[model samples]
Target: MRLKLAFLMSAVLAAGCGWSGADATTESGGGTIEYWLWDSGQQPGYQKCADSFAKQNPGLNVHISQYGWDVYWSKLTAGFIADTAPDVFTDHLAKFAQFVDLGVLRPLDELAPTADINDGDYQEGLAELWKGQDGKRYGSPKDWDTIAMFYNPGALRAAGFSPDDLSDLSWNPRDGGTFEKMIAHLTVDKNGVRGDEPGFDKNNVSQYGLGSDGAGGGGWGQTQWSAFAGSAGWQVTDRNPWGTRFNLDQPAFQDTLTWYFGLARKGYMPSFAEIGGNNPVGPDKQIQSGLAAIALDGSWKISTFQNLTDTSGQKLKVGIAPTPIGPSGKRASMFNGLADSVTSLSKQPDNAAKWVKFMSGEECQNIIGESGIVFPARPSGTEKAIAFNKDKRQLDVTPFTDQVKDKTTFLFPVTTNAADITALLQPRMDAVYIGESPVSSLTTVNDQLNDLFKVAQ
Candidate 1:
């Protein structure tokens, strides 16, 4: 895992500028540390964290930047190559392994210990994910997430179903089971015909049964088809963390995706063409505008969907449901988490490490939890987040945690060559989703990926 990306890092990294250091200060031998993250929704909570960290360590300052997911990676890669990356930045499991292979991450082992951080401080197994094959740690756990189905209670009732009906929805690749039935029933045509009704036109849909945030969630599909596929007993890789082989070509996986994308064909889902304008409409907007009945999304989105309001500023009524049970006879959610990492290029590695440490601490994590933005890393923080959402915000978030409690959550696949893997898979998956290519074509793509992995760095 350490050197797997040696073959592709240069090509993937941008060709411009090098190590532009963060703004430095001479105050009592302290300096400013720049932190970058991709989620705008979590910015306010993290900003408070930054403020608190600075107050605790006088003379040191923290600067924060928020970028969209796509821009965040591109900018991080550019910074890495140009030597101008932020001092401390949020890291994803998918990308961190590649960063480890490229030797651009400062191992957290020694630094983590100094701050009294250990794997026990975070959700089970999250801290272990940042370790490379060489046993060097690169990330300190922050917050965790799992996928769930988000729905509009009003739409479900109008469709002649109640929120409880979603509690036990079952699915299968052959026919989509009760889950697809619910989606079809929830869909409404322009002329007021439901999708399950006769003469329900596939075209001219007034309300799609499902909404999406992207074309296909790239290769990971954490919020797209992951839950469905996983619950159907499809594993993304042979194992987690160090697995080199992908299961994209597996029959069950292919069949699952074929049915998932086929929903677009049935006009029950948002087609790429429908959401492909300059500004793509996300699930939240679709649900808020009464255009989509439900969407599969990450727990991180609880507040986003729950806080959604209409044009008149009235809060939209949204409900949460677990992933539908599948042929595996269980529900599944991709267990993903965010972490903070200090860059190998940082001008203030110590301060940056300290900031990363502080972010994972009880106070900072609790602040994040109380904000109702996300579930923080610590157990206490997770409890606080649940209470905040349930008691204060009037939202029960157990569906997200229930996956973990039931042991139906799978870890995000972690391996090197992540950027290359996505680069290879995204376009082909998009083609499949848009009906340009058969789902079976992924078999060849999987073979090609295996050849890349065979390099053994």
Candidate 2:
């Protein structure tokens, strides 16, 4: 059942099916441009920039529409099939190669202001990360984010440790390490049971040290799992960007999974079944309900965490940390970037290009950064973003942004059939997390993934 739902969502992320049709059209005038996006939270931010663009191009009108991520993709795929796709649309690194291969998206180099699109000005390695296999840049960056360890301050204090102690800690898969020790310490139970305690009850625990389900969701795309993959020095593919290969066969990959899932097996973290409900998007119910201490989450969770009030409307205190460095001697993470791509089918290519360029430009990025929802893609915009969040409850987010500087930052896998590979892999991964299966699932996952790449070849 879990596998079926995961595959269904993967199709939505891959092709965008079964949604209301996109009937919104750009104004007939040379002035109006159509724009589409998935984030409602970002609509206001985009509107601010659209207003600015309207002022500058007085004759031009910007039309913006919001769609749920699933619906957004479905509508987008429908638009492409009908040749009525939006003039400008948000894009992502995971699926950009397929669009590039189909020749539907306009390469940014063909548009105006090419000189201002300085890849060097952006964070090291990130701008280049958005370029497609056709050797053309499809979109300039809007913002960037990396995974970090978010914890409860009170929980850490009660465990006889200060958050400061973990400020520069690292991890590896030896007998025991700083990271494992911390997880054990942070884990507590009402009857004097801790993860390291001899008689710790894996079945009946009070507060789990960590909170997480297995990896891969549309929002963050399998949070903890990807980090584990990176720490193991695994890449989803080697040849073409669209090729799929599984790293699960490696000792490092298996080792990382064992260590990560150990948190659950040892009663330090919630079981996979405990968190992923009929709809996996729920409040990691354990963490939100305060039954768990630390959970793997994204930067955007800051707002949800802030607004999450108990029955009495009290806010939770959250602290942030850089992902733990692994045996590879480096901190690693899976970084996914979304791009704005113009459809080849658009009748108003000129207007579409302008909208795409403007939204991905510095001004638009600044507006989004100012809202504190995400970090601006440009390195220069970091200060403004930090200032915007300086007064907010989620302070010290600088480290989250700072990790982007680490050389090991990686973009998510991109394969023509990646959607299919992820679909096949996710549920098997879920089974592994639930302890319903073993390392053998790796063989099935790898074979399925490789089959997609074979078809691509």
Flag regions of model 2 displaced more than 4 Å.
Answer: 1-30, 113-116, 190-192, 217-222, 239-246, 281-286, 391-394
**Model 2: per-residue Cα lDDT over 1-457, one tens digit each:** 9999999999887776556555555333467777888978778988999999999877888888899877887798888887667778888776677777778888778767542577776666667766776668877677776777777777788888888877766777654368778877777777867777787777877788877745452322446766656765766566434344655577767676767776788777777666664255333345557676666666655565545554465676667777777766777776665567777776776777777677767787778778887777776565677777777544878657766765667766666654665577777777777788885667667777677767777
lDDT of 1 at 345: 83
Q: Which regions of candidate 1 fall more than 4 Å away from where they truly are?
A: 1-29, 112-116, 215-219, 277-279
Q: Which lDDT values do the candidates have, in the order given? A: 0.86, 0.70
lDDT, candidate 2, equals: 0.70
Error of 2 at 47 (Å): 1.3
